[model samples]
Target: MVGEELVGLTPEMIEASQAGMKAIGAAIAVGSTGLASAAAEMAIGSAAVGATAENKDVFGLVLLLTVIPETIVIFGLVVALLLIF
Candidate 1:
């Protein structure tokens, strides 16, 4: 969108894109494992609570935390889409 050129990306843009991809990869690795552990903890807690686990307060918190990992992937996809376009 520069000067009505609608030009494609430059070398610097490509490099920045590569760097962003690397960062996203790192984030996914760290985030996914964290989410998995948190979910496991939630499962354990639920098992402990057993019959009294009808209340969703703890479940909701764990669900939100688990979603953080997926959000990183979503953000990575958005960046990839931007690069493609």
Candidate 2:
């Protein structure tokens, strides 16, 4: 995008530029949330694993807790899709 002209641009070119910005926004949305989810899961999942190892009966609860972080990624994907289309 270096050396790109800003002046004397046609309507179609301007529209295309806006569309590209939207795509970048969508990518940021999904990527940031995905990273957040990963970080949350890193701590929660490790703890869950240890908890489950200590008591077999706690496996179900830990499993549920481990999976809850993933919901943020789903929401991010939805937002990204909405931005793109």
Candidate 3:
């Protein structure tokens, strides 16, 4: 009886596994993109600081460039929501 129970795959168990997988995928999507965005921002921020130091007039352009990496995180959040829902 124990062997039979262990051998059979139940519908609830299948559903639980599917839910776990979906959660994992969502976490990965959000985490990876967040990390990428952080790295991009770090690189761009340093470059922007240097550029701003060299020319005060280019501050606006540098600020725009520095903010661009934030979109990656926003896209990541969208992907994670899609996976969850």
Using all chains and alpha carbons, the TM-scores for the candidates as numbered come to 0.39, 0.85, 0.76
Task: Please provide, for model 3 over 1-85, each residue's C-alpha lDDT reduced to its tens digit, 9 standing for 90 to 100.
Answer: 9768757778899788889998998898889989998899999999999999999999999899988988988898898899789
Q: Kindly give the number of clashing pairs for every candidate.
A: 0, 0, 0
Which residue pairs clash within candidate 3? none
Clashing pairs in 1: none
Q: Which stretch of 10 consecutive residues in model 1 shows the poorest summed lDDT? A: 64-73
lDDT of each: 0.61, 0.92, 0.89
Candidate numbers, best lDDT first, in rank order: 2, 3, 1
Better of 1 and 2 by TM-score: 2
- True-vs-predicted CA distance for residue 38, candidate 3, Å: 1.6
Please write out the lDDT profile of model 2 over residues 7-81, one tens digit for every residue.
Answer: 678889989999999899899989999999999999999999999888999999998999898999999999999
Q: Which structure is stronger by lDDT: 2 or 3? A: 2
- Model 3 — TM-score against the truth? 0.76
- Can you tell me which runs of candidate 3 are displaced by over 4 Å? 1-7
Cα deviation at 28, candidate 1, in Å, is: 1.5
In terms of TM-score, which candidate is stronger, 2 or 3? 2
lDDT of 3 at 49: 94
Model 1 lDDT tens row, 1-85: 5645636778799788788887776666656655665666566555646533766566766555545555555555666555544
